[model samples]
Target: MTPIGEENRGPGLDERITGALVGAAVGDALGGPVEGYSPDQITDRHGGRVHGIVGPWHGDDWRTARPIAPYHKGDGHVTDDTLMTHALVRVYARVRDHLDAYAVADHLVPDLMTNPRWIPELEAEALPLHRVFLAEKWLVARLAYGHVDPREAGVGNIVNCGAAMYMAPVGLVNAADPAGAYAEALDVAGAHQSSYGREAAAVFAAAVAAATAPGATPDSVVTACLSLAKDGTRAAIEKVCEVAGGHGDFES
Candidate 1:
């Protein structure tokens, strides 16, 4: 196993882990308020591109706002994405070992269900369960209530990004080892996702793992993703990269 704090001639593993986790939280906070809107819509609503932290979409009435009601999704507040990421970090801290589906059942589910933590989006202290989206709630339902085996719990849930969204930790734990990250993420994600969703989690973990390697670059990360990704996931990434190659910048 790769040492947790190994430094392979670039930033130390600890630094990479901090960068990845902090970056994920910041991006989540920035994106949460405009999550469902298109880029054009967001630009129009914000009177231009969002360049920094902004307020709730509905301002003072955010508590009663439709669609985003009750959740204060802006002003540097992180949505459940960051919350799940932190939860996964705690899981790793407690386990002190690589995790799999059973680990999610034994540790993650209980953490979500029993713990009352400060939830930024809710602007109050509450159980993580209350803030979790439906797909995530499936973890508790299947394992805690439905008595489903952890490895198979994800079989019938809607194929979505729930598992992939917070999988950076898996990649971090398996730093510089994209293949290891891919395999481990597949096992861990089996508790929450299947089919394309499961595959996406693994591929995303691999991308992060690849990025942590010494001298890794965007091209290298994409190469790692292509090497490990499969089926529609692979085709989709290839198409995106192909289309992206024609553009000079995001604004194009």
Candidate 2:
């Protein structure tokens, strides 16, 4: 049994699910401020620390580094990653099943471009679906050939944590089902993220799924994530755990 399996020997199902979603959102928000910063920068700002979601924190310059929409400031507001995760959760609540690439694309891309819920910074970056489709015309062209380039299918917009951060909800919806969450996250993440970026999203999703099981602890959740993540993400998780361990509790 996984560490989560061992921990989840007590809590009710609803409690576990709630814990998983809350954990994901908190993790996303907490990590938002430090996204893409080098370990040195992170250490300098927060004293080589990992923090939980509590109060607002400042993020690095989005314009110079990640290139978010015009309204974006240095404040720690979540990017498209969290927003798209919420969108996926809404869709899953309606359908109560897994989603396909086209289904997620149909909802996320167009919505991000037009939705007022997005902060001004993100809204400004939204591209019309028609433009994205046209730019990736090969996606449609290759539909007949049974092959589509995932990279070409989405608009060439921000490639930061925007897509990955929000993907946690996918794992929550598929709680105790890591494989399913990984597959679904990849399908959606492939459209917007690639390389380490996509891998980070997938690992987060899988961790949420594993953490949703009853009685699961934060430690177990981190362990579960390590099994699936690679490169920077895995290293980040390790750093988070190390920092968490030194602290008395998340509130401290």
Candidate 3:
């Protein structure tokens, strides 16, 4: 890696960054239908593996797993991951630099409400943010309309991967600087997360910053994660990958 720069940088840096962003969107759509299904369940239902775009859940065992409204997901559609990421992207475009929690209330909320954009999976033009999960909607409502403070906006909400999942762009923007990315993600995640979920956002941003660094490789990415992760988080990943190593890649 020649380091991140406009001049005298290594080749393919731009492509890799583009790959990171586009790949996140495409992968989100592909994985949307099977979002909550176990690997075993997916194989059982799809008869080995999913190939092309699939429709909504057809099984009877899935009601409890779906969102309350559950607006016909899958079928080339994306979930909250893409929605939030896109909103954040727009905020970055406006700011043209790093951001913190206040940007969530200022830029993201209006984008979610007024902006009409095409949802790839839904294959329609609407307020793309309308498809966000209820929990996410709550954050926006609290910040934009409920008079909540930006720093305390995430209080009383469920702590989950909702934050960390979409923070890769922060890492991408602050590429090669894991600490800066982690700090920024932590600050911004406060608008929609607390406790472990906020911690996950920091870890994820750090991982992205490290992965997007010039000359980053798969092994180096794992190394970047292990360096920043702590205790059970690191151990759990090691154990899971150990089991995953024996399995062949699915032909999807």
Best by lDDT: 1
Best by TM-score: 1
**Candidate 1 lDDT for residue 40:** 93
**3-91 in candidate 1: lDDT tens per residue?**
76654667776788899999999999899888889989988889999989999888899999898888998999998988998999999
lDDT tens per residue, model 2, 1-252 = 557665647776677767656655566566656666788887777776755432223444444453322324334455434455566777677667776566555554445445546342343534322223232333333332334454444344344554565676778777887777887887777765666667777887887788777656776666677767677777777777777685222221
Better of 2 and 3 by lDDT: 3
Q: What is the C-alpha RMSD of each candidate to the true structure, in Å?
A: 4.9, 8.6, 6.2
> Residue 156: error of model 1 in Å?
1.3
Model 1 lDDT on a 0 to 1 scale: 0.91
User: What TM-score fits each model?
Assistant: 0.93, 0.57, 0.81
Give the alpha-carbon lDDT of every model: 0.91, 0.59, 0.76
